[model samples]
Target: MLSKHFRWNKSRVELLGMIILSLFKIQNVQIPKIAEGIISDAKQDSVIKRIYRFFKDQLIDAVEVAALVVDILSLDKYLLVIDRTNWEFGKQSIISSDFI
Candidate 1:
């Protein structure tokens, strides 16, 4: 389904799936924790690096992602709620959002 809209190569799509699964398994968005949850033959550090590169490269388009969600849910009409928050997680400044 993702391949139809995104230009990502097969491996990238697979990596995205892995990341999503890991997020569900661990219920955390932090890179290190996500990396820890990932099941891969690659080294943990390598997986972490790959995840960082995935975001750093900006491979995802938000508009396309929204469209994909709509299609998946087969929604004709729906309410969208988005909440944005800015805070500090340890020494790092974090901006987080929830969309429903």
Candidate 2:
């Protein structure tokens, strides 16, 4: 799916590899942690920055990718967990985050 959307070969491979690493590594979801688990290099910070840039660029449609993931997961029974958090800034109320 990513291969069809991501323009760069490096981006496609990195995205797929990181996803696979996340699935295997149950520790933390942070970029540095995930990069350490997958990459053999010592410079995890650089790898993390690269990953940040890849996502910051928004090379593909996030909504489409999310729908595709949900559809694929629906094939088998699974637990879907969502966590919501509310935040306040100054006198204004910021939108709550929806985490899965």
Give the TM-scores of the predictions, in the order they appear: 0.74, 0.51
> Which candidate number maximizes lDDT?
1
Show where candidate 1 strays beyond 4 Å: 81-100
Whose TM-score is greatest here?
Answer: 1
Full-model lDDT for every candidate? 0.85, 0.64
- As a TM-score, model 2 comes out at 0.51
Q: Single out the weakest 10-residue window by summed lDDT for candidate 1.
A: 91-100
- Measured with C-alpha atoms, the lDDT of residue 35 in candidate 2 is 74
Expressed as tens digits, the lDDT of each residue in 38-77 for candidate 2 is 6546477777777677668755666666666767566565
